[model samples]
Target chain A: MYVAAKGGEKAIRNAHALLAKRRRGNKNLPSISLAQIAQQLTLAVDRVMAEGSLYDVELAALAVKQARGDLIEAIFLIRAFRTTLPRFGYAQALDTSEMLVRRRVSATYKDLPGGQLLGPTFDYTHRLLDTSLGVADEAGEVDDEARQADPADAAPVAMPRVTDLLGQEGLIEAAPADEGAEPFDITRAPVSFPVDRSTRLQTLARGDEGYLLALGYSTQRGYARSHPFVGEIRFGDVEVIFEAPELGFELSLGTVQVTECQSVNQFKGSATTPPQFTRGYGLVFGQCERKALSMALVERALRWKELGEEPGAPAQDEEFVLSHCDNVQATGFVEHLKLPHYVDFQAELDLVRRMRAEQAAERPADGIKEAAE
Target chain B: MALMARAEAGELEAVLAGFAPLPAASDLKPPEVGLVMLRGRTGGDGAPFNLGEATVSRAAVRLEGGASGFAYRLGRDVKAARAAAILDALWQDEARRAEVDAALAPVRARLAAEAAQVRAETAATKVDFFTLVRGED
Candidate 1:
């Protein structure tokens, strides 16, 4: 049974007012602009974009600012905003092979085609805080001339994928042929069990980074261990193409930066198939390297049944992972505890009180007898 | 359309403003902001999968002279989307086509320069690994 409880509108309104003031901080300090967050706090923006499942840097930055830097809140804000906009249609599948390579590396190979480019990464940086960053930028500071490259030194336009090299020697399993059929849309339909690879990939792609990281770590700690090597990880921009009904031909819809990881896992030969290296793939919006790698590991671990491997780990259970992966859904259920539950609590209280009264009536003199004893 | 889509936030709008008395075009489809679900292949070459969605604004316009043009671009710049759609309609006419190209030339150049700059910076980081010779060798 449910009952209505009201009369907090004024308090709610004032709380919102207080929140706005708190979000602003000191009045003397200049407020952070959306541009600043979009450019400097780019990774934060990227995270909200990835998990929110909506790619718009400006909006993500806005959400970050509005949420007072609370990433989960920011993601919630982005998701709420997503419901207002209508879906135009699906775009053509992205071709990562045509990416304008910014950073490309392979852990399994020392030397690969097109060579490795480090780009701008914190991988080699010392963890010590740089006091220099605390100070405002000095105007007109120039970049090192020596760091600039000659046009002739540029990498080849298209770097061959690391998997392809292994594939040529029949060491790695070949990719299934492209059927050109439309993939399942998770956003449109409710997720059911026995989902296809497409649906699983979509869920993982939009899943929370921290959750995926923990699950991936579990796999590495010998829970359904699949000896995995990062075949390739690349981050860069790729053009998005959409086919509009009004426009008969496909049209380019600008570009988006994405990080992609391909994990090569060992698969012992099944009774019917030969022994070969299997694969796990991850692709996410913007330069989210860690998240992409984690997604790949978890994705591979989840494929145990398909690969004929014994499955017992938490990550291998698709239902658990998919159901709990979405932070928006997870936070909603967890946070709803804060809302008024007076009726439900009253019912429980009544039940408990009645049971206590009955117990006292049944043994009215037991308390005095126990005390005397 | 590609050049316009790649143009800076206000670049398209500024170019459109230059042609003060714009060629009157009817809205075949008014500018509307929406999402476009982006798809990706499982293994980069195999079965398809949904990656995510991107914000897109699209508009369709028909010029007075009976030419129709449409545009779809990333982000929520409604005015820029409409401006690109108008330019597309104008570009269908042979005489107005050159005018459109001349206006968008700077954007094309800027995009090219930006691409070149990234390519150069990336090139500088390209590693050439060499194995050391063992003393026995």
Candidate 2:
């Protein structure tokens, strides 16, 4: 009797069991808790949240654990989970100005109204490994000097933005505000041609960090090269507001931590437009400042339309950049080719074979004679 | 007998009162409608093929003041077809529009609430990332 694939199900079950056992490793080793992962590996949680387009640290931590420390897998899990969600009311346009400034810095200015608060950045930290940290148990208390250095005690002040300073002196043209225009929903609606600024920014916010990094790097190396300066980069929590149907206006619902970047680019004078500095903006969820800044630079490069520049290069073309930007869609389309396609492939093979036979028949009799000789 | 009972109870009159009669219905015979082909797949497993067409009946009723309603269903059941035609007529009727809207109100409200709940659950898990050096052994 032919026993056809009797052990397939059993083999699959056994493999799954083995995988679970391997993932756990030696039981003696302390299992990593979700809280510990969230608190200790916060950057990974931040990346998962940023790319996954989810904000919950606990969920991100759980995803990291479930994915066996694979950040991409964690991101994929979050994205899949996000699709099941339905959109309620749109949040009121975020006011970045009112953000409780955590880390705010302007590369364009040496001194600003609100002095540069370094916050908790590792910009100047030495890359040396601290072996002593493994033995160190007791956490140190805040000294009197450190307490006095805290910027939180400072008065609530509305600092003039560095970009505004340039606009004040006519170094850069004022950004046109579209208060009436409704921003397109990138999640629900399919992204079509001639995308608006809001839709473009939304796509960039959830874009793959590595992909954007490579593209941004390419731009720096003279691929549609545009001289850019980090105008301002800020990371902090901003309140999300939404309009209730009963209430005519808007009200604050909750807050989300975001990284905002504004990149200033050098603009040459066009025939109709005068020479003035143009701006690129990137705002992403969580504390991914580097990714946000890279996104901002790429965004400015993509703004060939408003800049009155011809789309001769890849970066200058909006359709090219936006179409190929999403990693999820790209990965899905690429991997889908691996699915069973023997029938379609067989049809193509038959067509090619028939064509070759027809071509051979159509060839000269002399060619056949020469081959025979 | 049922038809006679309905006519005696003024049910047909009440249905007609809801909408202005269609210009085409002036003729004694009921209005003619066409079937829409229903496309479906065949084969238990492996590559599925389109399994031939099925006949469907469709009708449209236009009320006097420009409002219109449509009805469509598989197969030709005369009574069901007539009932559907009457429903279309009632839907187009300006007098019964408020009733139709009231009937749909609860369903629409439920759908909206479900959508809002889905959004809340999804938004609750949004995350952002920061760079960090991984611990080395």
Scanning candidate 2 chain B in windows of ten residues, the lowest lDDT window is B37-46
- What TM-score does model 1 achieve against the real structure? 0.94
Which sections of candidate 1 miss by over 4 Å? A1-4, A137-144, A359-373, B17-20, B129-137
Estimate TM-scores for all models: 0.94, 0.64
Tens-digit lDDT track of model 2 for B2-120: 12111211343344444454334321234343322111110001111111111223344554444444433333333444444455555556777676445444445654454344333
State the RMSD for candidate 2: 19.2
A107 in model 1: Cα distance from truth in Å? Answer: 0.3
Off by over 4 Å in 2: A1-19, A132-153, A246-249, A271-273, A337-373, B1-137
Error of 2 at A65 (Å): 1.7
Candidate 2 structure quality by residue, lDDT tens digits, A233-318:
87776654444343355443335567777788887867876788877777776778878888887888888777776667676677
After TM-score superposition, the amount by which residue A254's alpha carbon in candidate 1 deviates from its true location, in angstroms, is: 0.4
- Per-residue lDDT, model 2, residue A90, is 45
lDDT of 1 by residue, A162-258 (tens): 9889899888887767788788888898888978888889999999999999998898999989989999999999999888875578889999999
- All models, RMSD in angstroms: 2.5, 19.2
DockQ, structure candidate 1: 0.76
